[model samples]
Target: MSLKIKKDLKKIRKYIDKIDIQLLNLISQRARCAKKVAKIKISKDPKTKFYSPDREAQVLRNIIRNNKGPLSNEEISRLFREIMSACLALEFPIKVAYMGPVGTFTQKAVIKHFGKSVISIPVKDVFNTIENKKYNYGVVPLENSTEGIVNNTLDSFIYSKLKICGEVILPIHQNLMIGKKNINKNIEKIYSHQQSFAQCRNWLNNNYPIAKRILVSSNAEASKIVKTESKSAAIAGDIAASYYSLKIIAKNIEDRINNYTRFLILSDKDVGPTGDDKTLLMLSIKNKIGSFYLLIEPFYRYKIEILRIINRPAPETNGVWNYIFFIEIKGHRKSKLLEKILKEVDMRGAEIKILGSYPEQLIRENKSNEE
Candidate 1:
């Protein structure tokens, strides 16, 4: 408006434009370096994996630690992640498969970890897709803070040879949405994924008590159905609402305010440790007195922090109620202490299977708490 203000704005714009050129030059240099690295890897081994989860995790962690910014660490990390993602694409276009029709939480996790530059394929069956080598990586929901572990993921882990390469913790916010035609009409039916239904059970009971709830394969699917249906609403995330052009009737309908869903990045290659790592293992012990105790005693003896342990009914063999234990510990499987503990458990006559070690994503204030 004023001459002085106009002059000051022009000066600021000039500096910003100069900084933009510098940024462009730096990023281009980085991309060239990434391409060179890829060439070297290919020359060394034709089958080398271009994307390294361990290296990426370490780089992100280092970025966060060194960040002294006006922008939050998260914001800075996200900017760097996209830059890295683009550079990696220059190296080799990475393809990832996720449980999706798109707009699902698993897709969101894939994007969050790999960035939008990756080629993320929507697949009805993520496990099979990855196992068949259709995609280099796959993502699936592992557990939720409110609903606990996803049984399907556990079952897949029991049989699938794919390894857990990484993890992403996404804060879930369920919204009640409806199509344009149904916005004014009374919602007679609600659609959502089963886990979403469980997450927002109390909220739905209080707000839409008489509405008939329908379960679908995914929240995205529910949104897709509700987009054309009158007198119907869908419980889904913001992404689904945007994708389907649905209007939100209610936001954050989940009963828990701090709800989070942890998704696992599955791949054929094993990820090396990043010091702060979590290891998952499956164990089958004899169905006898103190068998469980013997299996768990090594963890306590070796001072390993047991993050979680879930017991599932093993296959019914000869009418016996045998159980399998899924245990998550704080240290990586490569650690000597952990190797020693695994040997001890194996020597105790328990069948132990190391699922994988991945960089720890979710940090709890109190490790004992259920989050």
Candidate 2:
């Protein structure tokens, strides 16, 4: 029986080795193909796009649809995402800018979307890094499931010309982490971002209501502070915890179980279409009795599906309770339906600006990450 078990184990190991060799050869071949694409891109057009969001979306969707394995569809898609990222990097490295202190959730989203091979530039201001022109793209948090939309990111869209090309939904799992300190250490203060504090309010109240809670710009910043302060703890995600070598005293302490944050990928180029796209529009109609109805009536007529509607103060619109509507609707801006909708909106003296058309992301578990 022992001999039989040993023989079987040796046979399985041989098979695994063979499979690894085949995978390596296939990856090398794919890299060669990517090199050919690189040569073609630089042959004439310096403005040629090395990355295509629409194409990548279509590929991942197809991967999910055709996947037949023990692994979940999400797992398969993630593996392919990294494969595509690596292949594309062979052609040209994708430089991405994200609002960060290195270990923020925004940085995780960037890695999840673009993979580890791309150059990730961390900056305090999302505008500065993206506007620098050195980075190929930018990633910023748009909204959170627990909290509402990130107003700063939305406001940035009002003036920034960067187009939203793709999106990533990160499943947030907040942890109570301690750096170089024992978990049993006297906890006097808790450090966390304002949003994270809100998300974990219930848990914090229940666990350490008496502890002084200090709000910081980002959870990453909180994590950094906790590294120096022995009597402090930080509410942060896995990235920060891992980066600072922090031990998690408590896991998934978010008040909401399904905490998720949606991030936007901004780029200079436009994606054609991926069948499933959402266009963002900001509009201000003429202040009148029926202006609001008239402004949105065309969407109903065109059978457009409005996903979300956010109203921001229109300072330009005088003191008539006038507001600007930020709308996310289904379909591309260039589509016939949208073109018709825009014409109707323009005729009504509505100041409408199409922020961008991007691939709509569905619910995804960013918590379950694998190489």
Candidate 3:
């Protein structure tokens, strides 16, 4: 409109263009450096792994610590994560497997943790896929804050040799969505995973009280159902809506505002401690009086903070009443104190299996993804 305003706008645009060029050159330089590092590693050892969880966590933590900006630390981390991901791809493209038909929250966690540069494979069974050497890593749901632990995933760990390498905390935002064909039609039926329905029961009751509710295998399945059906809606997350090209009628319809799901990163490689870590142990004690006390006494004596403990029936036990305990503690398995505690538990007649020791990732990232 004004000549002075137009001149100021032109000046800002010119500076932005220059900065963009500089950024491109710097990124190219970084990519070259990553390639050199990969070559050096290969020369030393042919079986060297390119992805290091402990190193990545340390880098992210350092970035967060030194961040001083108008942009939030989470924003900075997300940007750097993608940049690092791209650079790593230059070294070697990594493959990841997740439970999916596509558009599931687990896939979202894969993208959040590994970035889009990775080759993410959606499979019916993530655990078996990784175990069969079809994929380098896997991401599976561990627990939900509102609904509790995923028993199936926990059960898989009972027999699987995979180790937990990392964790992702995703804030789940369930949405009521409709396909393009049913945008203005009367909502006759709704489809969603049972967990999604349970999470959004109150919102559904308030909004679509008379709609017929149907349960599906997953939120992604619900989205797929709504994609082709007329006068139907799906209660799923943003990824499902985006993947299926559905229109979100209601956003964040979960009953609890703070609903979050924790997903575990599974790999064959074990990770070293990153100072702040959590260890998971599966223990089966002898069916005797004070067995539980014996198993837990070590943790108390060591003053180790117990994060969670779940008791399930041990199928392999000779006694009908024998149980398996999954205990998570706030320390690495390699720690001297934890090692001592493990020995004490073993001496107390408990068969202990150290599941994994991984960096705790409770810090929420504000990336705009599905869950």
Which candidate has the top score in lDDT? Answer: 3
> Which residue ranges in model 3 land beyond 4 Å of their true spot?
1-8, 366-371
lDDT of 3 by residue, 64-157 (tens): 8998998777778888889989988888898999998899999999998988899888998888998998888999998998898899999888
lDDT of each: 0.89, 0.86, 0.89
Task: Give candidate 2's root-mean-square deviation (CA, Å).
Answer: 1.9
Q: Please tell me which model should have the higher lDDT, number 1 or number 3.
A: 3
| lDDT score, candidate 3, position 345 | 89
**Candidate 1 residue-wise lDDT, 1-371, digit = tens:** 99999999999999999999999999999999999999999999998999999999899889888889897766777789899999999998999998879888888788888998999999988889988988899999989999998888898877888889888888888899999888576799999999999999999899889999999989999999988989999999888888899999798888988888889899998999899999999999879999999999989987899999998889888888999999999988899999999999999999988889999873322211322
Cα deviation of 370 in candidate 3 (Å)?
Answer: 8.1
Error of 1 at 150 (Å): 0.6
Name the TM-score of candidate 2. Answer: 0.95
Candidate 2, poorest ten consecutive residues by summed lDDT:
362-371
User: Cα lDDT for residue 318, model 1?
Assistant: 88
Residue clash pairs of candidate 2: none
In order of lDDT, best first, we have: 3, 1, 2
What TM-score against the true fold does each predicted structure earn?
0.94, 0.95, 0.95
lDDT of 2 at 1: 67
